[model samples]
Target: MSKEFEIAREFEVDATPEQVWDAVTSGTGGWLWPMEAPEPRVGGKGPFGSEVTAWEPPHRYTNRVEDVEGISEQTLNQLDYTIEPRDEGRRAWVRYVHSGIFVDDWDNQYDAAGRHTDFYLHTLRQYLTRFAGRPVTAFATFEGPEASSAAGAFTAVARALGLADDTAEGARVRAEGPEGKPLDAVVDYRDPYFIGLRTDDALIRFFGRGHWGHPVGVSVHDFAPGADAAADEAAWKGWLNGVFSQP
Candidate 1:
């Protein structure tokens, strides 16, 4: 059965509205997945090869998607962003709306998509606060084994990284890197389904999808110049395999 869904978020970023505009419209890779650079104008090609429905620089932008690889055309997706600059500070208030129609597994898909929406927006705040204007130099993702699809799989990895369940945002984190090195970061965002960390060089996200009956995974968004994404992916893959007890 097909159903309509809406995931909405409103947050403040420590950057100008213009900066937020640049990030979402041009620098999606810093917090979200790598995407083709969006064409800059109304009626131009937007992300996901969708058409730009509305455009008002540094303030409002909207896109509609009717074609997604491997998805039914019964689905229609739209991303709308509204940015408002603060009166007295270098901050911006952003309202993001992602409304669409889902044709398969509506309940499960909505749950997953809702949790992911919060995490992605949190990462956007982290990117603007810490790595503003810096392009994503490297990006990689790794998934855990199916055996790791338990409700506590993400917490298990966090415990291995030396964090307790009570860890709070802004806490200093010292975790073992994939290459056996010490990684120092701060807990930027944390919740039952996700842990977000910001290091000097990267934003790391640990997913607790197992909570929703999906395989847990992680993604690294490196901002360090000349970072090697392929190597990072390989190292994290091996590390995650070990965490999930994959042979």
Candidate 2:
């Protein structure tokens, strides 16, 4: 007989259950979790090659195991989430159950699941809090002839400056530029205000505008292998013009 493993966690979130539910159900929201992709409907496919067995909106959701690799025989695994009202706002409870197994060595899987659950819940909280008490009309703009190139270069600079990460929220491209580059680089635009980095041939700049506000600006400067200051300045200005003039 395979031993069963169960784990439960609770979290108190400032956002309402509805807000949390929307984030959980949306495809873009799935990025907040460990799943490569998560379809938030009953009978829908999810990470771990499982299927959603139950979905009750902001109240409850459940997943059933459908496939497992390296296991002698297929078994059942379950994940469930429930939300309830609390004094200040709402609380969430996540339950995971594993059944049917051979040799019973799932410690690593359990740990990974725990981490993913925490990440998902935290992302939901962030989304809700960010939009809370704020107008729904926040917007941004990239005003330049080479807006696309500028934006792409800006993102590269951001990565170099550590202002953004491959896994951070809003790190995903929201819009693409003319040349298949990411135009609107929407990340968690918060503290540190700006970033700067030096590429092989240029100095890249990235300015952070708060979420729902105007972006400061981005610039690129040229740098020769061992050119004088004046020569470097001229080269930088020329490169800037060339990059900014793309049609």
Q: Which numbered prediction scores highest in TM-score against the true structure?
A: 1
**What does each candidate score in C-alpha RMSD?**
1.7, 15.7
Q: Write model 2 residue lDDT over 1-247, tens digit each, in one string.
A: 4545565666766667776665555533222322434576788886677788778877777776733554645546676667665654554443333333333446654554454455444434544554433221211112223332333444443443334354344453433222333433444332243433322233333343322133334433333344343443344344333444545
lDDT of 1 at 234: 89
Q: TM-score for each prediction?
A: 0.93, 0.42
Off by over 4 Å in 2: 1-3, 30-48, 69-72, 87-104, 131-247
lDDT of 1 by residue, 1-247 (tens): 8899999989887899988998888845998888876678889998776889889998999998884655777888999999998966488999999998988788998989888998898888888888998989999987888977986788777876778889999999787877567789998888888888889999989998887788888899999989989988888877877777843
**Model 2 accuracy (lDDT, Cα):** 0.46
lDDT of each: 0.85, 0.46
